[model samples]
Target chain A: MAYTQPHPRLSVVSNSSHSSVDHLSPTTTSRFSLPSVPSLHSSITTTKPGPNRPNIYDRPLNKTRSAEVSASAFAFLFSEVVQYTQKRVSGINDLERQLNTLGYRLGTRALELMVWRAEGSSKAPKRELKLLSVLMMVHTQVWKAVFGKGADALERSVENPDEYMIIDNDPLIERHISVPRDMSQLSCSSFTAGIVEAVLDGLSFPARVTSHNTPTVQYPNRTTILIKLEKSVLEREELLK
Target chain B: MAIFSLWVINKAGGLVYQRSFADGLAALTSNEYLVLAGTLHGIHAITSRLSPIGSSSGVQVIEGETFKMNILLTVTGTKFVLITSIKDPTADSVLQKVYDIYADAVMKNPFHTPEMPIRSEGFDSRIGTLIGTGQT
Candidate 1:
């Protein structure tokens, strides 16, 4: 974490005493074998050992699952979520925004895990063009993971072309929400919106997700999240076969 | 069995809400309603304390003119007192429907405080519909 401004190789020679073996590691290749690291370009220039350096991304993500959690436990947890967004917001729109962001972030991690735990392992896509298909897969799979069922509906916006909406009836988290008072504007299911955004970003879809209230009998809190794709993504999609 | 109105008592025995669906039951002043809630809360608490297992099957069957205000309660010990003057015997189901509406509109509402006064629009409106439901 200590990111000191690294002095140039020529400048370090001015400190003549401790500079004897200043740049020896790269200059003198001993028995240490280092693989070709693209981001490790500056390693050859460091005169002093960058303290406490270890590869951070080398560790696995899923450390462990809590032994006690079950289906009922999730329902209660979802109840708490319904309560959490109750206060500390302006109106229904803000509440929905918050919920959308939560859902989107959860979507990100869920997408990665879903792909990893699939019947066939997935290779993470590197380019934007190959990512829309991945994005669709993420919407379908990750929605099923968190919401307990696949999304009720999905459609691209006709006029805008870049906008899309993923519909969910009876989002489990919203089952317990009974928004009160001046906040009777919308359900507090914006947490789901966050999870959706997370999945989109994780799959390199790069879109914004906002939850809209669309209530039906079987699906009271039918959230239709409008996702507006970034221009770069549209261009990439057009370029791809 | 019949009901004419509904009242909810908080855990501490405070009467937070009261609404009459029928004509037999008279309205109480705001302060009187509060006093009533407190008294009922006390009674429910005293009854619960009488139990060895710490559960109160709260006060029911407050008989009135050609009508009755029967009480049901949530598992959390909050009272749901319903008043009805209906001649039909199937009055219990009406109260259950009230609870269902409460659970969906009020309990599911993030803005609703559990065991507090029922102030949700969805809740109040739905209850209004349930009360006048075939009572022509």
Candidate 2:
């Protein structure tokens, strides 16, 4: 503060009109010091800070910022959506199908945004991909968007080359669903159906999306969206690489 | 006013849901309720298209002086039938509210099975209270 103060000849003290820089001609007003300031003053001047911070912000460590959202608001909106789709549908299949279709559309939009976010000013995941590579994209990109975490596992079907399943432990979509007896067979994982569908579709691997419940030790609401890829998709994967 | 019954008929005049909320209608077998739904569905269709020009075919109020019969039809050719002996000015509002509840809580629910009996969690419990209160 003492070294940076302007020459007394250019004294302007207004908050908005400040150009607070001055040099000591006679004396720059004896270095103003508080009773408990001697120790703090030396530390502040000696610290080799990475960069000089602007006056607009507080100390570097205290300047953290992030957007905030209310979880209850999201839950309420989701509840309304679930209620609306319940009106005309007949069976469990239809309910799950609707949720899946909704999830798939959202998945497409999320995938696009995620790619943009990750690839900003940097080389992104290139076009060519093995099945494993695609799974990684879904894990790191799509899963983060949906559940705030990547999927638990992506397993290739042992019995069938055309089949793969992305496992989500405690899927967010199933959180509000308390299916009734009339819909005893209905699983609310269909919302994830749409998301997984979008990922496969984006990867040029056309597939059917289906959600089924798999209760477990850690997460009871586990959902595995089974993606059965078309034979042509495999061929395209080969040709692209 | 006791709610005599509620029926849901598809466009094809098939019974999707039928339940008795009162004791007036002679107790019918499960098969009979289904048949009643089917029969009412057919009658509703005949009445809707029976007109040469067009038909409003909805909320046909049958004033029973003490009680009232209400037959409501959706645009998709589904009918919601409610029979009650309560005469109140707010009866129509109550009925409309029921329809709104069904559309929002039941129709939009991703868990609701299409063309199936309503089994949504909020739909069932909430609609149950609304319908139950209206009956009293």
Candidate 3:
């Protein structure tokens, strides 16, 4: 793509034979160069073609293709993402945060697709209203649809009314990931947590989802993702319940 | 007399996958097939070592009375073997296509742990269609 420099139009008047005779002289060289004139309003204008794909806003975001992708390919790509995030950050927290941010974006789109796919040929699933119902949807339907298995368990926190827990014996995203010894405290499962958080936030439930590695003798890679709802969410839940 | 079966042996001489597409031949138990795969792997290594010239390119084909088996060893040491009727002329190319599909369907699948049994539905359906097309 050639980018033309913005230059004011130059107008030149030539005196034919008389100017031709004077053009040879050193003093007349100035005639060839146009004086720099200030452009009126300085409109640096160029036409760029509109994007080839249809405008994102103009198209409905609900369509989904029933396609399967190789899990190994996804694992390799995800590993590279972790490496890339690791290179940019100084510490584990920063890396985990970047991964969470990436997962958050994916979660927003995945939630839409999951809801559409699950609702089937009929109208979309009724907007998930109650807190417990949405949590059930995620634990059973969404988790199974995404991972090919329902999450191992879902339990409400007995100590705190606003807190909930979703447990997975083995999360698919971290199946191939073996974190180094130094970053043992770091669980990349935050990415999946971010996804859960996005789904909840999309349903208007403000919550923070964090991953905890509470491994047991049986389930070595067991993960318990804690979802802490905002104070207003509990109040609203009480009203709705 | 058509495409009969296929086997995928991992680098370590373990049978990772086996599928029979046609029925005329007698079927072996899963353990017997595993033993057969290990035996073929040993023969491949032995023959490569016994090549008179310095070149030990390994086993490429085996022709019996009724069936022909073609082998294609990938650079990564994954072996793809195709068993077909003696008349099938393009067995090598079919095995090549099988290798390509394996790379895509088995290797690329994130759920597939290395050297595990190959059970991807995509892989199975693609192979089925491929062999079906080969017959007609």
Cα-based lDDT for every prediction: 0.65, 0.67, 0.78
- Residue B44 lDDT in model 3? 88
What TM-score fits each model? 0.65, 0.46, 0.50
Interface RMSD of each candidate, angstroms, one decimal:
3.1, 5.1, 8.6
How does chain A of every candidate compare to the true chain A by TM-score? 0.60, 0.66, 0.70
Error of 2 at A22 (Å): 34
The alpha-carbon RMSD values of the candidates against the true structure, listed in the order shown, are: 18.3, 18.1, 14.0
- State the TM-score of the second chain for every model: 0.77, 0.75, 0.93
Q: With candidate 2 superimposed using the best TM-score fit, by how many Å does residue A224's alpha carbon deviate from the native?
A: 1.4
Chain B TM-score of candidate 2 stands at: 0.75
Q: Identify the candidate with maximal TM-score.
A: 1
- Candidate that scores best on DockQ: 1
Rank ordering of all candidates by TM-score, starting from the highest? 1, 3, 2
lDDT score, candidate 2: 0.67
Tell me the tens digit of each residue's lDDT in model 2 across A100-183.
788888888777766655555357546636877887777666776666667888888899988888888876656545566655
Regions of model 2 farther than 4 Å from truth: A1-69, A237-241, B1-136
Q: List the pairs of residues colliding in candidate 3.
A: A70-B109, A71-B109, A71-B110, A72-B109, A72-B110
